[model samples]
Target: MHGHGNVPGMDAASEVGVDVRWSETLRTYHAVSNELEHELQAGHGLGLSDFELLKALCRCCAPDKGTVLMKDLEAEMYLSQSAFSRTVTRLEKAGFVERAACGFDRRSNFLAITDAGSERYLSAAETHRAVLDKHFG
Candidate 1:
């Protein structure tokens, strides 16, 4: 039965195919994520989440100021608030980013990429692209 006999509207063969595809997808994701994590950590001292947050901030930051609202960035991130906050805290500790209170909204905070962060991001980005290209390109 392969555990698919109970699945309604799906034939055994289709169920097996789906399972194989799902397994492959999981394997690929883990492989790529592991590689990225390794390279990023060795090359930039950053994890995947750290690199991603920096990249996103660099992309969405105000052109002149390199700043964005925490709420807005949080909305874009797929992580839970606590996870996002932890990442932010790590970056802030590393001097990669800064946190500021929003003047207009007391409840809102702004994140700004520091000069050091930009440099790290630029360097890490090259490593990131190379790893992905090596795997997929």
Candidate 2:
């Protein structure tokens, strides 16, 4: 009765344990993400989210093709709709990404990584992996 409303089998101690673990997980996520963001921005002028977007596009496309549908990219990103759109616009302006109409659906757009974008992503990916290796490996 002193803790969060009880589930059938769960107790206050269990609730506290869950909360502590969740808090730690969040803290770790933030720390790792921030470090990666700083490394990417300092080394490549790309933010973590920007690098992630480029990586997603590259993963979705073949070596000869570097395009992903806007919807698909949205599904891959953790950002809100408005934030994703803004990120895309920012990358486009930076010449790292390009948006084009989907041939099958004029209402839909496809995002493609440019040569510059691919190079940036590839370089930043090394830093990203190194950071992860340092922390999690």
Total colliding residue pairs, candidate 2: 0
User: How high a TM-score does candidate 1 get?
Assistant: 0.89
lDDT, candidates in the order shown: 0.93, 0.88
lDDT of 1 at 57: 96
Local accuracy of candidate 1 as per-residue lDDT tens digits, 1-137: 35536656657778779889999999989999999999999988999999999999999998998999997998887789999999999999999999999999999899999999999999999999999999889
**TM-score to true structure, per model:** 0.89, 0.88
What's the distance in Å from true for residue 35, model 2?
0.8
Output the worst ten-in-a-row residue range by lDDT, candidate 2: 1-10
lDDT of 1 at 45: 100
Candidate 2: C-alpha RMSD after superposition: 2.2
Residue 8, candidate 2: Cα error in Å is 10
